[model samples]
Target chain A: MKIALDTIRHSLEGAIPGVVATCDANGIPNVSYVSQVHYVDSNQVALSFQFFNKTRGNMLANPQLTAYLIDPETAARYRLALLYLRTETDGPLFQNMKAKLAGIASHTGMAGVFELRGADVCRVLDIERVPGAEAPRALPPYNWLTVLRALGQRVAGCGDMAGLFEEVLGGLEEMLDIRHSLLLMWDECGHKLYTVASRGYVHSGIGSEIPLGCGVIGVAAQYQTPIRITHMAAEYSYSKAVRENAGLDPQRLETAIPFPGLAEPHSQMALPLLASGKLLGVLYVESAQDMRFGFEDEDGLSVLAQQIALNLVQLQQAGDVETDTAAVAVGASPAGARLQIRFYPANHSVFIGDDYLIKGVAGAILWRLLHYYVHENRTEFSNRELRLDKHLNLPDIDDNLEARLILLQRRLAEKSSALAIVKTGRGRFRLQVNQPVQLLEHEVGAAL
Target chain B: MIGSSAGIPTPMSTTAPSPPVLRPEDADFIRSGVSVCVASRDVRHVPSLARGLGCAVCDGGRTLRLLLVKSQSEALLRDLEKSGQIAVVFTRPSTHRSLQIKGSDARLETASSGDEQLVQTSFEAFADDLLTIGFSRAFTGLYYQHEKSDLVAVTFTPDDVFLQTPGPNAGARLEPLP
Candidate 1:
């Protein structure tokens, strides 16, 4: 029976390393262990090109070869009669294989020794399963397609950006059973990704930043590809690097919110939230169990990420159109102790009474909100007005006002309980503050 | 071409040593619970491979006799019958310690006296070995299970022995075999 390459994708995820057998020019056969066998498509797969070994020599001489893979879960074996194709040194496939190889190397204690030189593409001429090799097995616990559909519905039911973030993050836990996860939005101008929403952590880690091309999440965002690391490697863990990212500037170090990534996650997966080639950000999930997220989980999460990205795109565009510029500040402000709000335009850092609240775009948005509340005596504002506000310096096309509002709202709720921003209507919000406040704006400084 | 995870992957470090003889430790390691795979190629140069049930080092570590399930190794057995060249890799999962033994002459042989017990012992040992590395013993038992009647041994006098452990020196010849 002809086997489609996708049907057995779990076997190709390198959960159990595969063996590649090739014949040299003299018809002498040689076999070796391969760290990864990446599924390119229905008809092709890419093997990691590590060194110019005899296997490489044989492939150049005899393109026809055999590769044996075993399912990590079932242990069922299959043989792929592959015809060697071209090698890819760059692009999504190469990046994916390279990232996977890094994790394998780190897990195997061969980090620097195991480097991916290229991705050796192979045309799967045939796939034959070892007969009677499989023992009777129980059915899988979950179907990713059904779970993804349910997640999509949960996200679509939300009416606002905060609700959307809440639903998606909540659905990941409730529906897919992904307890530890976070939502990040791309800061295109800053060349970073910031945590907008998170779940299953003691600290929300909101406003935590990771530079592009740094850790798993950063690398995922940089290449716009999904990265799955089954075993925790020190260099790939984002928690420490995120702190470093936060401390890139001395001022940022002082104001950096604690990065809430798992300190020692055994399994980590980061899928880039991309929409039509442009990356929106990244959706990251992690666990303390070895091999928690398999290939199917990655595929499911990628689907969910795309859904969230599309909705986010729609939500951001919708924020631009739904404007009530003449909205009035309602409800009398309560009397309380005076709170001094400091705004640093350099990094858009916001602090109240020496306590840092948030920075980056969210901080800038917070400053703009406090400005109107302090001088203009306004509480209610529209997203459109904020988008149009030139002083905020938000990007013109993908301003991402909704995400910034969500971040600012979450941070304020966590840090400053007395001052909170609540959505009033579509594309509008009311900043509720019980205490009297003083606004102090500072000069621009370098940001991390 | 044969390698596992124990060696560095540097090409310069893989310079071949003199003819390798399997050490007493290699024989002991082979008899322990380690995974095995056998490779052979057809006249057309399309190689074939299959999971090995177990391996037995005979003739004071100079020859290797590998166990394979006949049903799963039809093509490989056919290749071996056509071209007697063979390469077998034995690897311990827990440590990633691996060895590749190659031969120019491979012969098909039926299970001899005590071979069934060897298969069962090797399977349990391999399964037990895998259990230490997080694989459930029961699951690995079923994965490595071999029926007595379905087993066949492919015996070969090894002409080459190489360090197949992954890393830079993976393909380097294992010299001064005992």
Candidate 2:
């Protein structure tokens, strides 16, 4: 009886090495061990091209082939009749396979030796189960349909980008049973990803950045593909190793806050958030146990990321609106403890009484907001004014204005500073300063 | 030294300039807790695989012997019977150092007295290797368990040897043993 290849995907993850058999033109057969058989789709699977061997030669001469795979959880064996298609040396599939192979190689003690030259694509003609008397019953890793349904509803209910970020991270933990995860937004100009929200870590790691093509997260964003590594590979760990390997300038690397990752992560999955052919960010997750995240986990997270990307685009589009200048009159200056606010014009780094608060677009937003409050006597602001503010230099009109505001608000709350921003309504927010404020602006390259 | 006095023909030599032969240096590497997988295909091209319990080299390194658990190798054993062709891969779990040997003449025989000890030693070494890499002892123990009665011996003469390591010169053959 023929079965669909998708139903037995656990066998393709390289937990139990696959075996491939091909016959030469002279009817001589050859069999070889396959490190991994990547599941491209229901009808297609790609084998890693690490070495030029008889199997490859036979496949080039005779496309008829057979492969055997075994499920790690259950001892069920499957036989696949395949037809050789083409080889992909680059692209999303190749990147995904390459990243995964790194982890496998490292785990098997073949880190530098195993390099992916290409992905040999094959058409799975038919799949048959190798009948065995022992039927092992193992619990399914996760119910993808159930988790996706519940997560879709949760994401849809989020009224704003902030709520969407919170719900997505929370949903991953509560609904999908994923304990550790992070959400990073893409910095297209800088070729980096900045951490905005994360769960299951001692530190939130907000504002930490990783360069594109540097680590697993960066590679996923660079190729706009999902990279899942079942074993922890030191070569792909983010932060210090990635920064050092990339040979990034120390000053530039210093600007990037260290990523909060497990000291020894055995399983990791990074999925790119792509919408309309543009990468928005990456959703990353890791575990201390080996094989904790399987193919099902990657598929589920990929679907969830698609939903998030769509919602993010929709929320950003909805944030573009006209500002209300009627409430320009600021409240009377508060009589209390003095709070010092300093802003650096060069990099937009903001500090509150010697403690660094934030920088970049969020810092610029805060600087402008405070300038209006102290000088222009404006306590209320809208997303439109911020987007239209030429001085702020937002990357685009469709910039994530609302998301930036939310991030700024959260950072302030976390710092417990005397200043706060409250959402008054859709597209509008109000600043509430509890103490007398001393605002200072510094020239470029000036020390605080 | 390309052909040498060893009977092994080094089939991969024609494909590439270098001839890769089974050498003494690779003997311990292959036998030291490396992952061993044997593969064969039925007449209709349906492949079958079974994890080898252990492996041994004899006949001046020209012949290879693989020990497999009979109960777990129903399909693979049948495939071996249908066609005398077989391929076996020996890969060090830690280094991914690998070697693939193809044989045209294959036959099954009863397990010899020393073969049980070979299986036991390989199992222990493989478990230790996996433990170093963070695999649970329980998982490894259960993964390689086999009953003494369930063992079978598969012996084949090496017709071809290929460097299965991942690199630019991976498939290149080496000179035969002098």
Candidate 3:
């Protein structure tokens, strides 16, 4: 498929996503999609890619690679970069990159990619950068798990739900440099748009309750559609609760609250969080910059919000299902002498602590250890005998068993200061602690 | 791997001794992921023991524990007397050769001697070592009487050590556990 580089560049500049590829010394092939790619120099360019899967594998095998963006619509091709293979570098590539990409980087506010690659023989230096990609979508387009994982960080491991909302809004504000961000919840019981959380807003709790079908949020909730109000005065769905409450100038409603920022809050979007046929919540995103929430942002954030809602449901359900067999006690405080403990409800979410947390196979391994301890009285088990016992309980595949345990170890390391989970000596493992660990507290069934 | 010449079986029974030694051939069997069959016989009625030896090639360490059942229940006492008079032997880890017991050792004929006996004589045999020998379910469940005891069968017990299996150069020795 020989295509003109200028045509591809123009198509990419118009709105075409790029395809990434890399090869090793052995001629092994790897490919992926890149959202952001910029030139470091005429010969080199830097690209940022989410870490995982085939791309990581290729990088490990060989760092030398090439990335290209093709515009089938215009038969244009943009040869992005041909990277140099090196673990160590002190080149002028980074400086050349900051000049070409600093403006977009500042606008997007994403971390700059450090790795650089020289240009291939064919180059289109004067090609305009495409704001969006327009092409035939692949089947099962985005890798769901990876996208979920990337978005999972926004909501996962939140200590307090309400408090995390504020933090999340702040992070989103920082990322987009939006003047204002507010999270509205349509209280199913209350039937009102209660401002549960917000950022860049006044303390008077302005525009608190927008009844169903009353305002932009109300229309969003009623019609189950997003609202992007560029002008509040002309918005028939605009209902100002603060203006109504103050009882001043019903006729001067549009002039009452002079929200210069809201009047021209260039880009705004309201996405409903629907999961399993139920609308749990809605996300309202607005930016001071014009045309900020485009189709890409709308689609991505809507999917992201949907994931959050699904995960929220999972998180709630997870609390009901005991993830860990042994319940460790929490801090002993508040009630003076009363002791408190918390067990990780069995689920994939890793346990959290200052120095230790149970994750993945580590949880499985810990579960097994606890199971054995509960079943039989043992302080230490030899590796030789442990496998025999573990095999009796699980499959005899050692690699599969160990991989899970490693996940648990990493999670534990992240959660707690104690790196003393896996011990080795005399070919046996022993849990060492004089005081009863709060981590092992749980409901004891009739059967041990 | 130095220990007794007695090798252990996989899926060890609860009654089997702990820390059972592994045999050289048993190691090969385990490594090969192969399964083996263990069998018992009554040589008196089935006197084709010599012919059966040829079929024991795939049997690895073919161990034969022959039990001589009494033809007549009453003749068990006389049989026990002779069986008790026979000697026994055992093997060591260091030496691959067999060591036999000395003198007139007697197998107890059902504690006292008033009960009916099933087998007059019982001999233990293995390719490697001799730790202990046990009776088969058929032999143990038989109707028997012991004299001067609560109706028990003639049960013979070895007093001194005896060579359970033949020599080391012929059969593999047991491997020591961790």
TM-score of chain A of each: 0.93, 0.93, 0.35
Best of the candidates, lDDT:
1
Chain B, candidate 2: TM-score: 0.83
Off by over 4 Å in 3: A1-151, A204-207, A229-233, A240-264, A315-448, B1-178
> Model 3 - which docking category?
incorrect
Candidate 1 runs further than 4 Å off? A106-113, A243-255, A327-334, A445-448, B1-20, B143-149
| Model 2 Cα lDDT, one tens digit per residue, B13-42 | 334434335677776677788877787766
Q: Which candidate tops DockQ?
A: 1
Candidate 1: C-alpha RMSD after superposition: 5.0
**DockQ for each of the predicted structures, in order?**
0.36, 0.22, 0.00
Model 2 per-residue lDDT tens digits across residues A1-448:
5699889997899876787877665445666777889899999999998877778888888887778787765667777889999999999999899988988888777788778889999999988775443345667756789889999999988888778888998988887678889988887655677788889998777777788887788889988999999998887887545646555543333253557878788999999998897888899999998878888788888898999999888887777654554656865788987789998877787888887887877888998988888888888988887887898778873356776787688778877458898988778888878788898889987965
Q: Which of the two, 2 or 3, has more DockQ? A: 2
Question: What residue runs in model 2 are displaced by over 4 Å at the alpha carbon?
Answer: A23-29, A133-135, A241-256, A321-325, A445-448, B1-86, B90-98, B106-156, B160-178
| lDDT of candidates 1 onward, in order | 0.81, 0.78, 0.36
Ranking by DockQ: 1, 2, 3
Clashing pairs in 2: A109-B94, B18-B173, B19-B173, B19-B174, B19-B175, B20-B173, B20-B174
What's the CA error at residue A213 for candidate 1, in Å?
1.7
